[model samples]
Target: MDKQTSRNLWRITAGQRLRYASAIAVTGLASAFMLSVPLVGGYVLDVVDTQDLAQGAALLVEAANTLAVEIGGKPYVAYLVLSAVAGVGLTALGATCQYLQGRWAAIASEALARRLRETMYERMQHLPASFFDEADTGDLVQRCSSDVETVRVFLSSQVVQIGRSILLLSVLTPILFARDARLASLALVLMPFIIAGAYYFFAKVREQFKITDESEGALTARLQENLTGIRVVRAFARQAYEVEHFGSKSLALRDNRERLNRLSGAYWAVSDFLCTAQVCIVLIAGGMFLAAGSLSVGELFAFMMQVTMVIWPVRHLGQVLNESGKAMVSLGRINHVLLAEEESRDPAPATERVRGELVLENVTVEYEPDRPVLKDLSVHIPAGETVGIVGPPGAGKSTLIRLLARLYEPQHGRILIDGLDLLEVDRHWLRRQLGIVMQDPFLYSRTVADNLRVARADVNDTEMMAAAREAAVHDAIVGFPAGYRSRVGERGVTLSGGQRQRLALARALLVEPPILVLDDALSAVDTGTEGQIMAALERRRGRHTTIIIAHRLSSVRGADRILVLEQGRLIQEGTHATLAATSGPYRRLCEIQGALDEAIERDLKETSNAV
Candidate 1:
């Protein structure tokens, strides 16, 4: 694996320290059992050489004979009873041990996965909105789902199983040497060559697997983007284009997999051939020793059995190497997400109520240093005063409001609330004092009541209904099949444009903050409804400091003061009537709206005459 990916794998696996050790113990025990079997068989063979071969045979016969006579000549029945009892007991013990080991492995894998996801989510929550702008949603989903599953599978399936195999090899190899030094030494000569080949293959496999994982993540991202923007795609007739893009990503992933498989296959085939050659040499040498009277028939039989036990675990040594490579791949994918930079915020303190005077002093924002969105702009909103902000497209109106909310910090100057610099204050405390209603509001896929509750969870049903009534959405909500409990569907798609706008207004009202911002919030409503909402806002004008950004003159007509912007600079500031009387950009906007209204009236008259 690449160094960066290797480091990430090490970090994630490090969290499973205890379970890893337990896994080692369980695997070791299993390996030991496999290695011990041949030695036990050898011991039985030794008894034939030392004691009378007939006596050795007679022990089994005698036990059978005694049981048969006791049961009226059933020799087969006697043997069955003896073998069944021993087999059942041994099987139960082995099964119990294996089950516990499996459970430990599962616990380790799940626990590690949970911790990794939690850490990633915590980071995501803190990261700035800009981070989401730069990142792909589908790639994030893949990291949490398929990539995580890959890591879990390695832990439960490959890592622990490979450990067991190695343990068995270690236990069996020594026994073979102790039985006969010459034969044992001969078998071990092939070990270094096998180990070297395994490591070389492991390096290649790790690289290929990492590429495969990245390609898969990219494919997921492409599919998700296509589905989410399917409307645009169909409108443009780009179905074939999307399919081709998705197909390319999939093909890349498949090629990586095939490459890894080829490398793994080569390693296994070589290891298998070497093992077969080793076994043949052992059998030929053992036969010669027996013929020369240097080894008895029983001794030769035992040696052969021990040699048979050693091959699987020796092969397992290579398998373990393979598993390690895959684990490394999964670890890298998860780590990349964990390492991505998170959003920055000031540490919060205990609750502190805000006195709503907002000040922006010579503030400037440059997304890139040479190109400033807002340049040395300064403005103030007095407590309990309502101000309207009127600006043309790309006039930095939205950027100004965002800075006041501390969603984006000004790079060149400071923003203050009640004369204190905003940077020094806690983020949560600052947010508690401000409420924003955007042009396009966000709603959860939940009930109307639940969405309102997000602003203030302790709000009662009576208070909730009151907010809805003030926003003029109460009657429509009550008419729904489930009333306030009706599901809004994803992003409140079930609600009409006007209804959704009012629901968002209701939600903002529930927060009850000292400062309120309305950024073209009433744009979706009819003129009559807009007038009614403005009248309600005017009644509470002196109770809260309100900032409204609008292009429509009628919406901002009731404000105490209006600020007009051109390009990214504030060009005019006064009451609506005062600004309208003076020839400027604000007057031009009013003229545009008047002409549009007159054109609509003429169209309606022409349609009536034709009818």
Candidate 2:
């Protein structure tokens, strides 16, 4: 891993590095204890075959003499039994260490995965709106889930195996040379080639892993979109087309995955061949040393056993290096989200409630360069005044409210809420002070009461119902199978379009924000129902600063002042009576809507008369 990647991993592994450190120590201890088994076997063979306790090294001779009690057919029998016990005991201790190593690795990896998930979720919550606008929901979900799993697998398995490979080499190489330096050199001649080949394969496959990850992400993103819009797909009878598109994404993912697997297969094949060749070379050379009477058969056996230990780990490392590449790529993808700049947060969020006085001075905004959405727009709505904003589509109506909520900063001028710059006030605090209901509002797949209570934690049942009643959605909610306990299915599909909007409106009202914005939020309701909700809002007059953005003039006909927008500029501003009497966009819209309504009314009457 590079220094930056290692640093990111260390940062994420906070509070759990000690556990990993312990696992590493345990792995080393396990390797040392387990490696002693071959030596014990070699020592017993030497003593039994030669029928002398002094045939092998002086250390074993002295230890065997001390450990063995004579209850023997031959002198070495008691020593043989003692050797069995020693070998079993060492193996058991090593196994125990192995178990501890696995447990610690698992615990640490799980903790890291949990922390990764929580950090991603919290950071996403604070990320600026533009991040979501440019990010795919499915790709982000995969990063949080699949990418975390990839890293977890690496942490739990590959990380410890890597430490084991290093320990095996560092500890065993010295022992091999100590036993017989000349033979040990021959045994290790092919080992460097194995490691070099593993890394060379690693370098080749890293880019392929990244490509496979991207393909999988794209597949999931397309799948998520199709599932979310299943209704739309079925409504348009586009199942075949959608299925074909999904198949293509799946095929791309499959092809990329197969390519990655091919590369892995080639690595394993070459590494396996190299490992076998090294083992054969060590054995052939040990036989030559034995023929020259310099190497004992028992010692040769021990050398073969230890060389196997070293050779297998070299191959094991090749497999782990592949996992390391994927883990590194996943870490990079996840870190991107964790490092992206979050929405602005004030060190000390404004604690005082805003008076809702809003001022826009020569405010210019643009989503794209040189193409302003709201151009030099200036307006002021004092506290407790009811204002209406109306414009055709793409006239910057929604942009204006978002600016007031501080979702986006103005490029040319500043917005003030109660004499404080929008940027100066905390973004979270400003949003809480403004209750906004969009045209197609979203509802959670939860109980009606839960969704309503989500807006204000302190809102009791009584307050919730009152707000719902004001939005004219209380009766509909009560009519559900379980009343307030009834669950609204995903995105509120259980309710009509108008109910979703009104329920969202009720949620906003529960906040009792000083600034209430209804951005064409009543388009789905009939005029009669809109009138009932508007009448309820009327009772709130002079108590809240209300701005209603509506395409239907009737929704905003009674406001104190109406502002009409054309393109990105404010072209007209007045009350209903004043604007209607004048010839401008407002009057032209009223005339066009009036003629359409008359035509619809006549058609209905003629059809009823014929019946």
Error of 2 at 401 (Å): 1.7
**TM-score, structure 2 vs. true:** 0.97
Candidate 1 lDDT, 383-444, residue by residue in tens: 98889998878889998888887778889889988887888877768888888999888889
Q: Distance from true position, residue 53, model 1, in Å?
A: 5.6
lDDT value for model 1? 0.78
- Per-residue lDDT of candidate 2, residues 222-301 (tens digit): 98998889999999999999999999999999999999999999999999999999999988989998999998878998
Candidates in order have lDDT scores of 0.78, 0.90
TM per candidate:
0.86, 0.97
